[model samples]
Target: MRYLVDLGWLRSGLSFSFGEYFDPENTAFGVMRVCNDDLVAGGKGFGPHPHSDMEIVTVVLRGQVKHEDNLGNAEVTKEGQVQRMSAGSGIIHAEYNASESEELQFLQLWFMPRARGGAPSYETSSYEPSQMVNHLLPVVSHTGSEQVASINQDLTIYLSRLERGNELSFHQEAGRRVFLFVIEGELEVSGHVMETRDTARIQNEPHLQLAAKEDTKYMLIDLP
Candidate 1:
């Protein structure tokens, strides 16, 4: 149901630079590929960059980031908001902290393109924190659920926050894989303790059970 990715395990080897956090794998997980949790210092940012055949979604947890693309799209997404960019065919974009003094923390997700070529598009929305309590709150989906914004891959992203002593379960499809990232507080997942920023990649299980040691925050990614 869920594998535990200890923060201590990943931070030991990973490095950071250019306002980027890299978590490369031999092969990205299913249709859902890259997941980078980044923290951008104020007044510093990422310049223009190129990407093609990928769906990039940015979810801010704190502070704000300004996004600008070659197609004349410019916007700023704050905490509680979701920004989706489809780099179909090809596109050049840049992201930086909008604030001059506050550090920005956010998650950048990349999904493999479902098809070869198409036009590019961008969409954004705000989600209330309460929506994630006791259950998964779909933030982005390939089919585009009502509250969840649309994307370009057959995957889903959900955010959940559980109060102290709360518990939750997640079920996986026959051949599906799941990734969980603990953002805050403590959790006992499958009997192991996971603290903030720890992640878990789980496969070969029908379901998972998570219990909150305190008010815990986390994300669940279901990849196709």
Candidate 2:
């Protein structure tokens, strides 16, 4: 199931119990606590906020994001960049649009860490747009073995940009969960047709298939 969240300058298609849209049965999926397709207004951004014991990931979809944290990392994440923040014990951070004239669009994901209470950390990585074309590129992973940023969780984040008619497949393990979030265009996952801002949650399934109905860009979360 999916939920639409349009908050004027800050819109999101939330995948879990987020903000005021709460659902006890839809609180979380596996280790994934939050999945939000966010679009922020230019010259406006989130103020400094505290977080603890959470692995946060920011996937830049368009424009750019500037991040400042108490850990002394003031970084800008551009389009196609992934920013990973591990608020082990605690961290205070602020996010804003890197460009005052352009809006910022991104996907912000939060996951429960395997263990908590350690020092906070931050890192970032980027990929070429063509790198994800027609294939799933591992942008974030737990083992630090993938060709992307490392995070403190047992999950993998895959990104793809498929042209119309392109096809792909994903295999899931028992008790694992998978989530599909469409960033642009359209795609068909199994028998479900998903458009922009739509998300599909999968579990207890063995095989997952995806086909591009139109030129589509999307994100997939493989969580335990």
TM-score of every model versus the real structure: 0.87, 0.94
| Candidate 2 global TM-score | 0.94
**Alpha carbon lDDT of each predicted model:** 0.79, 0.89
What's the lDDT for candidate 1? 0.79
Q: Distance (Å) between predicted and true CA of 1, model 2? A: 5.3
Query: Tens digits of per-residue lDDT for model 2 on 64-108?
Result: 999999989999998878999999999999999888889998889
Query: What is the number of backbone collisions in each predicted candidate, taken in the order shown?
Result: 1, 0
**List of clashing residue pairs for candidate 2:** none
Query: RMSD in angstroms, candidate 1?
Result: 4.9
User: 215 in model 1: Cα distance from truth in Å?
Assistant: 0.7
Model 2 RMSD to the real structure?
Answer: 1.6
**Residue 175 local lDDT, model 1:** 88
